[model samples]
Target: MRYDGSNELHARQARAKLEKLIKDKKIFDLTEKKPQRSIQANKYLHVCLSYFGCQIGETMEYVKRNYYKILCNPDTFIREREDKYLGRVKYLRSSSELDSSEFSLTVDRFRNWCSSNAGVYIPSPDEERLIQLMELEIERNKEFI
Candidate 1:
């Protein structure tokens, strides 16, 4: 199935919700154990690597080669990837909010590239769980808020 506008819309909505939760400080209580920055970064990297059809070894190699660059300036890495793999889409803006069409195009291109180059399909479960876990965490912390 091709990525479409609806998918982009949904992703934006979910991202907005998460951002709102974060802004409201409703997702985590300071008194409790908080999610680690490394964990969050790893989860995000996993999702991005999955989109690119990078297996564990490939992902590790990518991190090894680009970790410092990513840490120092993530937008550069994102822009490089977009320029390399997604010519059809406009460059990603620094703003957190993404244009739906651009987002859809990025996803489509990544999936297509991954399938053709790596012979691997994107697995939905991990991405789904990642979002779900955030939502659940927010829900669980609602009372504290």
Candidate 2:
């Protein structure tokens, strides 16, 4: 989906510019005394890799192992992932005061709703409980998965 303030063309343009800078060594220049930039470089690479369909952890590992410029900035990788998923959806603005209670209730209702909607009542109570446990696990790990 497109973000409200950006389009594919703009993104492509930005990427192209970054590619040009990297190719020209402008981004890696360190002739004079310079502040450390390995972390920033790596984080930005992770963001780019993610947009190109790499998983966050995999992209992070690849950049860390291969890139001399980004070996230091671990926080950048995490923040990039956070920025991608949480884009434009700030928690302060999106969350309600009742969010904690509402979220738990929603999960419970969803579990019951799924069970009831199954074609037929499952014969074994243990089987039903297993299903509920699996569902809970799935719900809890949804974001990472």
Candidate 3:
């Protein structure tokens, strides 16, 4: 269920569809009034990353460290550096991009990554539900696109 990023149109369509699902789920209203970098925001990001296999094993501590850095100045450290620091191979999008898009792409990328890497790890039932929702949305809307 990995999104075909090579197909730009399909990728954009998938992203738009996921964005709508996220808003409908009220996953973290990034409305103008909301503080973009609050504790709540970090918690939301943390949960999302955790669900996407970013916090496996000892990666939680690394995620937390970079998460704080992202909270402070997302534009400074690029995604490449973040991946290196996390000891992962490009598992995350740039903090600047996430900040600029209000984390819309972050959600899409995480979903895409998880879908392609399924069976690598087993998520909890609760996490599975969230992933399924996203996957269902993608599958249902992708046809319409």
* Residue-by-residue lDDT tens digits, candidate 2, 21-134: 888878433232223335433333333323212222334234333331232222222222246666653222111222333433433332343246532221122355644544
| Leading candidate by lDDT | 3
- Residue clash pairs of candidate 1: none
Worst 10 residues of 1 by lDDT: 28-37
Per-candidate local distance difference test: 0.44, 0.36, 0.47
Worst 10 residues of 2 by lDDT: 89-98
TM-score of every candidate: 0.30, 0.19, 0.31
- The local lDDT score (0 to 100) that residue 38 gets in candidate 3 is 50
CA RMSD, predictions in order: 17.6, 21.3, 18.4
Candidates sorted by lDDT, descending order? 3, 1, 2
* lDDT of residue 103 for candidate 2: 32
- Write one digit per residue (lDDT tens) for candidate 1, span 9-92: 865776676678898878543232222334454454345453332243344335323432233234433453345565654342
Q: Clash number for every model?
A: 0, 3, 0
lDDT of 3 by residue, 17-78 (tens): 77987878855432223324555445555554443333243243354345433433344443
TM-score of 2: 0.19
